[model samples]
Target: MFTRPASDEYIRYQNQYISIVPEGNIIELLERQQDDTVNYFSSLNEQQALYRYAAGKWSLKEVLGHIADTEAIMSYRLLRIARGDRTALPGFEQDDYIEPASFDTLSNEELLERYTSIRRSSLSLLRTLPITAPARRGIVNNHEMSVNALAYVIAGHELHHMNIIRERYNA
Candidate 1:
């Protein structure tokens, strides 16, 4: 089983997200989360899925898109680093991506379908990585990070957004 990442494995800013992940087999947690997230979002209707808790905040659809986008990015980083790639990966602006994504144009069902597909791809890639691959490190956003840390960040980031949807959006 892959172990949880230690503090030294990632930058401090990521700890806020990483800390939310419960101690366990991270791959299993990520796999279980796919269903949990899909079920939770699937429970919402069109109106609820479009809700924005406050002005300047993202609507539910946008948040879902953001989650999908982030997962794809992180998983790609994980793949590269695990494969012994040493190149520095560039950072992306989430707002820039979200605005152009036109997530609102897509139905909630469609958004969920896309998210599920991306997550399954990620799971497939992660499952194929060797046990030692988790320890592989690479530069991302100018900071060094391990494949394991990125995995935790992927899971914890979703948890963060889910908490926001529950507390702020009341969904």
Candidate 2:
């Protein structure tokens, strides 16, 4: 079984992401997330996909794209750390990524396709790592964190966004 990362594995503020992850094998959790997200978002109509709860909030399509984007970033970070790279990765600004990507222009199918493909690549990467990979650490946005912690953070970040998509977007 893949071990769950300890509290010391990540930053304090990151609990908002990691704390919600249910106990399980991290790889299985990721696969379940991939299936659940593809199934849930696939049912939305274009109207629902474009819905934004407030004028300034992201539309559901953007939310979905953001999830994919974050997963890709986290997965890259995990890959690097798991492979023993000590590179200090830069942090991304969420707002800086949105409008520039033009996620609002894509078909729901296109958005979900991007998500599915990225997630598949992530799973392939995760499956190859040595068991010792989880303990590997690297600097991200200036803070050191473990590969295991980043894996959970990726899943928790999606859960956080999915909650908003459910409650506020009402889809």
Candidate 3:
């Protein structure tokens, strides 16, 4: 199993996400999060899901969509790096993706189902990777990081947003 990534393995700013991830098996932590996040968001009604705490901020539904989109992106990065691809990858602007998605237009059940499928796919990919995959490195958006670091980023990013949903949106 992949261990916690060292600080140098990822971008400096991404450390915020990594920092909140408690010590444990990475796969287990991700599995737990996959279940917990789905359940948490599923509990919200339309009004609660539609909540946006401030002007220009994302609604809770948008935030959930962002989380899934980010995971899909990060997981693709992980796949390339783990498979020994050395091609330099590019970064995506979250805002650009969010608006077109129109997450608020979709039902909560639809959003939750999509998130569940993506998380399951992520876990399946993680389980199938070779042992050395974690140490493999690649350039992503002009920065180099390890596949393992991407895994942590995925987990940590979810936590970061969920914490915000709880504290900021209060949904």
Candidate 4:
């Protein structure tokens, strides 16, 4: 979905808000992110998973699990929107998504595998997109979004969490 490139002002604003991984190829970013994400999670041991920087923050494992889950959901959004679907998608509450999951018991390797698989599929689909497809507008979570923007947002979102894992989890 090719649209005109994002305005320099908009790009600069987004850059200030999120430290995007420097890779311009979205496919490479998604693939390489799996490795980076896995490394981040694998560095944590059980005790580290339970450690929290603050009382209100999530533990390391919980944050990793959340990233795995969020990738699944977000990748699905990318898939649907890239297919040219215009239907509005539903939003989710992270608390609700995590409530029943026992993050403490899940192995970091397992979580990493799950995340990697999701990214593999997402990257494959993204590679098939015509240049113009990403700019196609779609409704996700009741909000309008361009598929191109969502791809950038997905990368940024992961970058944000990776920062949190480093700064907060120390794992």
Best by TM-score: 3
RMSD per prediction, one decimal? 1.0, 1.1, 0.9, 3.4
lDDT of 4 by residue, 1-171 (tens): 432235331234444323455646766776777788877667767776678899877777777778777777877777788788878888778888665888777777776777777777767777888877777767766567667766766677788888877775654
Candidate 3 per-residue C-alpha lDDT over 71-126 given as tens digits, one digit per residue, 9 for 90 to 100 = 99999999999999999999889999998999999999989988888889999999
TM-score, candidate 1, is 0.96
Each model's total of backbone clashes: 0, 0, 0, 6
Model 1 residue runs over 4 Å out of place are none
Query: What local distance difference test score does each model get?
Result: 0.90, 0.88, 0.92, 0.70
TM-score of candidate 4 against the unseen true structure: 0.83
lDDT of 3 at 99: 89
Error of 1 at 139 (Å): 0.6
Worst 10 residues of 4 by lDDT: 2-11
Per-prediction TM-score to the true structure, in the order listed: 0.96, 0.96, 0.97, 0.83
| Model 2 per-residue lDDT tens digits across residues 55-112 | 9989889999999999999999999899899989999998899999999999999999
Ranking by lDDT: 3, 1, 2, 4
Task: List ranges where model 4 is wrong by over 4 Å.
Answer: 1-23
Error of 2 at 144 (Å): 0.9
lDDT (Cα, tens digit) per residue for candidate 1, span 1-171: 356788888888889899999988887898899999999889889888888989989999999999999999999998999999999999888899988899988999999999999999988988998878888899999999999899999999999998988899866
Clashing pairs in 3: none
lDDT at position 162, candidate 3:
92
Report how far off residue 141 is in candidate 1 (Å): 0.9
